[model samples]
Target: MTGISYRRPSSYSRLIGVGGARGDRIVPNGDLAEALERDDEWIRRRTGIITRRHASREVLVQHLAEQAARAALDASGVPAGEMDVIIVSTVTWMKMTPGLAPLLGARVGASPSAAAYDVNAGCAGFCYAIAQADAMIRSGLARHALVVGAEKLVDFTDPTERTISFILGDGAGAVVLGPSDTPGVGPTVWGSDGRKGDAIRTTHDWLEYKYADDFRDVPWPTAEQDGPTIFRWATSVAPHFAAQAIEAAGLTPADIDVFIPHQANLRIVETMAHTLGLREDAVIARDVIDTGNTSGASVPLAMERLLREGTVHGGQTALLFGFGAGLCYASQVVELPDAVGGDGEYHADAPTAMSESEEIGAGE
Candidate 1:
């Protein structure tokens, strides 16, 4: 057998915020205010989700994306203007004209030349984006990379689709990536079974599937889902793929300091942690009591929460896994350094600008 080695980091992204939104969305409950036909207890037992916050579709996706980017930029000390690339990882992007990155750049004041775009691999969008950023950095094609995961699924799911509606919320999470020779996060792993891609889809109408519009044609504005099947899929594949990633990093399940599985459902989370033989007391869990499944935003949002509270302190290992929609999946291990700030670490909502500088370059 070969030896197992670990590469620890001295610093890491200082995570902050669940987009610092204005107010919390109400969780569906029995006889509670705006409770769906389904009661809270019933909803919780089945999906392990008691509540989730839905973003106002009226608010532009760029606003939430920029807010999260500001938080990551502030925490990482990376300037937005210097950012070489901005990847807005989401399936629910705004209108087709500007795409996500350009709009995000305008919102945050980044260099006009910075490359930006969007992607869709369902909830695995961030993981897909992470791999893209890593490859670009490793290949010397890019320097500072800003990764943001934002979703507004509530915009798509009408109230009738309770199976899908109550389970999703809207928010964004961001991280700044730079070239680093120093071992930082982990060598990530990506896997997919497109064979089941159609099992979960965002549109049912042929016109919708084609992503056509009245004036022109746009894709990915809204989404449709098959919730029950996807839930079963999450319970099964997420942990196994996460294990594959940990093993690739030369670490055992026990070595992981925290499990930041995507904040889709509590039952899946509870099951996956158990299957992986990890502790249930989470160092990095989505404060999902109300924010339900932000899909693409789940993992990074959880990372923000954990880092903000020092739940995942300096010098600990975290494993993050995400899977959904495309039947797509991804997992990775991250080493956390101190997120030391004066007033402890962070607050749920912040008032001023983020602390990241205006320049960008990978610091490996």
Candidate 2:
């Protein structure tokens, strides 16, 4: 109560200058949608979601991931072949080996040595990935890093786990980080807690039996949720961590221009906004109602929504909150530039040299 020490974030960090996003169509009719039909007033009063996006199984995680990555690559005017490293920040991946990072690099024809791999930090993963890549640039480890937050939750979602099904969606958002002379463009504040990992976690396993010629097996996928505990924990935990981050930068919550909490639940977002003394529209929130919780992909997905809809203009301070799974959470204020390379000029439809689906894998 007196003083909470949020481990200080690395100082050798720079702002991620360019941001990009792309997602699929989202429709309602899961759990909460029906609950809302039960009583519109009740649903609105309890949670703030009117609708959420649901990705089709046909749209693989790799497709959306590549689309989002290409958008950032196009918007930044930095060729995919020029990236220093491409970090895929996700808990859900296209495959177990090569981490999908290499697969992305290979498909795009980035330098053969273009470092690529996957890293997970629950829903807060994107922030963690950005912080890591920023440090690389600020530390002279690399000239540029592509951080992508992508997830095809459809791959792991257990429809039976209706508690989260109504609140989750699939999509990807990407940003390119490089050096900048701007003041607030780089410095960051971040932290994590592994103790409450189970507060919001997903688990999977494989099963088999020995039967020689007459062998048989039944492998199953199981996703669980302790709904109430997660909701209450998020409301309390997220704000505390967010405050800790803003405080670390010698700034108060008032200094932030936008608050982007992982679109977990409408109530959770509203509670955090109220606690932080922020206006409803001050923070960029959407896509979740249509996307559901794309796990760690949520924040960037929301950022992509703002970047495209024109809600988030250049040079705005954004306070992003990512909490879930791992019972883990972290926060950072990104001093995002209004345009690529601080160019005040804005482009509605940035162009990519080659479309992912069109260019990759010759035959669809």
Candidate 3:
């Protein structure tokens, strides 16, 4: 029998462009203060969040994802038609069928044949997706891929719930990956602690909520978490994983120019940074202060903010890590993208010229 042939793999993969999109509504602590019966100062002291974005009911998850994806594609100068894969990592898509990836691909004008799918690894989703995209490119499954982390946590957050409601926000961030001559995305260090999965999760599953005899009394499935438990786990585990990622990349704390961890909480970010003992000049993302905790979208959002603010530049070495929910986490070292697209403004009323078929296909 003749030997089977395989597609030629690329030497490596690297992020080519980056983009971010946030909801239009700016929700301040005062807006949620009455519901939580907590003052803005108290909330600020605890979470370091002054404001967060919450998309209006009319603004669907796909809109944010599309906006981010467009910006990334424009920045990369890689037309959507060239994309071979598109991955969306989100937990609050609110639907079980017709995944967000395909819809986003259609809306963004990616070739219909592109492999599209969704990933739900909780807050670590973006890093997980990036790792997958990198592997796909290196394995010759794809040459150019778009990886997006978008979420509408507001839809699943209960204002009356104090554990994580105020910390939740809605937004999306994305990156374009393509083949590179050398390693631009380093080895990923990832793992999950299923034993502590309950540290952060929804209050109940769909089945429980659907079967409840007292419909009104039964709370809707909403995000909830053991704050203290997650704090301890993240601070302790993040440092180790971050070091492993750096070491895997054949670098050290001194070599990392930026540190973008999951924007879950300011305290967690600070604790992990302190524990890691990175160089004093290393820039740590504090996007959580303004963006709140956007779950899966946090890592890329933080990285985008750093780039937009001119704090970190292209070719700079950075360590990106994310952890939450499923008690899962992923970290990797990467060379920052050279350019970013999109004005970082989300126009809810912006019109699109998508063909009728594309609109219908995207389920818009």
State every prediction's TM-score relative to the real structure: 0.80, 0.80, 0.95
lDDT of each: 0.67, 0.65, 0.89
Q: Which stretch of 10 consecutive residues in model 3 shows the poorest summed lDDT?
A: 355-364
Off by over 4 Å in 2: 1-23, 30-46, 184-189, 207-219, 279-281, 340-364
What TM-score does model 3 achieve against the real structure?
0.95
The candidate scoring highest on TM-score is 3
Each model's backbone clash number: 14, 19, 0
lDDT of 3 at 312: 91
* Candidate 3 clashes between residue pairs 3 or more apart in a chain or in different chains: none
Please give, for residues 232-313, the per-residue lDDT of candidate 1 as tens digits.
7777766778888999888888788888888777877777888887755645474666567788888777777677666767
* Candidate that would win on lDDT: 3
Worst 10 residues of 1 by lDDT: 355-364
lDDT of 2: 0.65
lDDT of 3 by residue, 1-364 (tens): 9998999999999999999998879999999999999999989888989999898876767788888888889989999999999999999886787998988888888889999999999999999999999999999999999999999888898999989999998899999999999999999999998999888888877777678797777777888999889888888876898899999999989898999999988989999988988999999999888888998999988988889889999899999998987888999999999988876656866654344543321433
